[model samples]
Target: VESLSFFPAIWKGITETADALRLTVTGLSTLFKGVDLKETVSGPARIADMLGTTAVQSFSESFRTGIINMFSFLAYISISLFIMNLLPVPILDGGLILFALIELVTRKKIPPKVLYYIQFIGLAFIIALFCIGFSGDVAYFFNNFRGIQK
Candidate 1:
């Protein structure tokens, strides 16, 4: 009975975390499908700016609201990152899982040279994504700044 007391809260957290993961997956799929890449994709700078804006607005409303909102936002970001890190890209955890699975099935290890090249490709892909996100952030800020000037 004592241990069961925390079940409801634990369940709620699990559900909410799953929801965040789903949202992150959906967002990534949408972006990859090129539905609104330029408008939706954001880099670290853009995310920070948005976070700051949200914090200001929420705190202006109420301290409690601000705290809740900030924590929620952080959780969402954390979940998104977790999902992304699990993607089957060579440099990430998912890539490691993929390699392990392949080795398990084939009963052999992947060559070091092959792994190196694959990781290089993954690095390139990550760099490309970073560039895209950074460019989007620059464009977003520039447009907003221009709007302010006008």
Candidate 2:
């Protein structure tokens, strides 16, 4: 019961951090002039010329589209966060509920060792997932850069 109380705090912190990041990116976008950071950043003028448009117009439209898309992207991200936080796995809210139900039925506290192991495994899995995603981002950047160079 005591452990379950922490889930709300954890979810709140994650949501706050995500919101902060979104705000920071939004702010930074306005600071740049005639530049589209999300558009590969490999000579925007050249790319715009190749695509048959002036650099300024292309950048302006890109920024506008990015701003519009961000709202929809945030909606999906919020949904994903809510769903993931509610999963029935250790170190998650559903997991806490499961533990509480077990304790209620069996009238025995789950051993601390087992709980610790479950959390450790979950943390490791999450770390591995992050690494994989980071690698994919790196690969995507390199691929896009190579394409632009050609």
Candidate 3:
């Protein structure tokens, strides 16, 4: 009941703020672009372009920019993966740690039945979340492709 009551106000605030921010950001971006500054390309495109140009010129011209960007992205992803694995949640590295700690303290292993049930629930939840995210991604791509076609 409390959440239901708060939903409208919370949603309204978010919608209004997002709309205002989008407009302001878009206007600022256009203003900046009009000044003829260096154009920004997508990361993959930029990396490919750098590699292609450098490779054609000479092997000595190390594609420093692409290499640096790739390493930076890899580092960020690695850190994120580590952090996510460390989360104190079930069916993850954290869950294994939790079980180990329990065994150490209680001097008894968790029953196999309980462990199986916990893993089952966790797997179901993960599958549901994956489906939701995959559906959203597919819908977004389909809509964008349709718009491009028209």
Candidate 4:
């Protein structure tokens, strides 16, 4: 009976995690397949702001509610990072996997110089993404600041 009691909780957690993964994948696909970049992409600052807001709202309700909300959000974030790490960007795990696949298919080791250039391009892409996200964060805060002044 004691063992049976925890089964439902475990099952629910597994199902919820799977659901979150599915949703994240779908969202990423939509974003990549021509969704409006500005509305979808947000920087670390924006994400932190959102997390702070969530924490406040959750704690305002009750201790148990707050704890649950924080855990759930953290789980979602972990899953997101896992999925993002699998994206085929040269600096990420997916890029490594992609390189391995290429080597397997061609049966030749990629040259060092080529690898350097590929990694450099990936770095540039990452920097560009950060710039875009940071700009968006700045605009968001600026607008909010103006609204408060009025």
Candidate 5:
């Protein structure tokens, strides 16, 4: 992104991003339906395990396919990251953007006290989410482990 200073570079990026977003949205549309959401939103451990399994399977198919598969997985992950960062949480880039938009429209700087509270809320929400994801991951791992032991 830093290297893309001019029009062509920026335009290409925008277009490619649109395509990636479309692909990602299409793939994950069901996740947003509020059905079995805990199972849907995987944590870091599950994500890593899935990726490792994919890489191994792809490599089993052949070296070229493995490379292509890894790149495709990365593209999807990149799209997910982009979308996640844009979620309107106060600690994320989206929150900063929201403040900027507000300042633009209101022609007044947001109160420092309000910003502090908002950030605190965001921090709390983030921590809660991390705890949930971590707990889910641990449960998932133990479940798999138990099945193996049986």
Candidate 6:
């Protein structure tokens, strides 16, 4: 059966998604102007390490402390997901938004040829960022182990 709640629920999701995108865009703008881009972007490995650290801490702490640690970690993961999904690199929510915005302002759809080129560029950019972040994660891990070995 149809329900009014469905529309409101959709709107709520859209609203939260937009707010998350706005937050991420604000952070990126800081990077565009040379505000320590290296520290802003994080890779999958870095995220995994963070969760692993939290998991270890939870196990070693009191039940109350463990719960707090886990909940905080989960919150961080959720926010990360919200931001990541909105990134405007091809095949992502942000890319879709960008295309829609352009169509809205131009009052015409972009040609498939031009869109194809734009998408490829976005994809390349995303891959490059991933490579950089992955390397950073590797270095971070290496430094950690080196300290322990020494």
Q: Compare the candidates by TM-score and give the number of the best one.
A: 1
Clashing pairs in 6: none
lDDT of 4 by residue, 54-77 (tens): 899999998878888888888998
**Candidate with better lDDT, 5 vs 6:** 5
Instruction: Give candidate 6's error at residue 17 in angstroms.
Output: 12
The 10-residue segment of model 1 with minimum total lDDT is 1-10
Question: Candidate 6: what lDDT?
Answer: 0.76
The residue pairs found clashing in candidate 2 are none
- Best-matching candidate per lDDT: 1
Q: What is the lDDT of residue 30 in candidate 1?
A: 85
Error of 2 at 134 (Å): 0.9
Candidate 2 structure quality by residue, lDDT tens digits, 17-70: 677666655644553665533342223233334344333444567875555445
lDDT (Cα, 0-100) at 24 in candidate 6? 62
Candidate 2 vs candidate 3: the lDDT winner is 2
Residue 145, model 4: lDDT of: 96
Candidate 6: count the clashes.
Answer: 0
Report clash pairs, candidate 5: none
What tens digits encode model 1's per-residue C-alpha lDDT throughout 48-127? 99899989999999998898789889999999999999999999899989999999999999999999999999999889
Ranking by TM-score: 1, 4, 5, 6, 3, 2
76-132 per-residue lDDT for model 5 (tens digits): 787888887887899999998999999999999999999999999999987877777
Whole-model lDDT for model 3 versus the true structure? 0.58
Candidate 3 residue lDDT tens string, 1-150: 123358896796577556655554554467346542223212333435545555555434456655644554444434544655655566778777988899899999899999899878777865664565456555555776899999
* Overall lDDT per candidate, in order of appearance: 0.89, 0.60, 0.58, 0.87, 0.83, 0.76
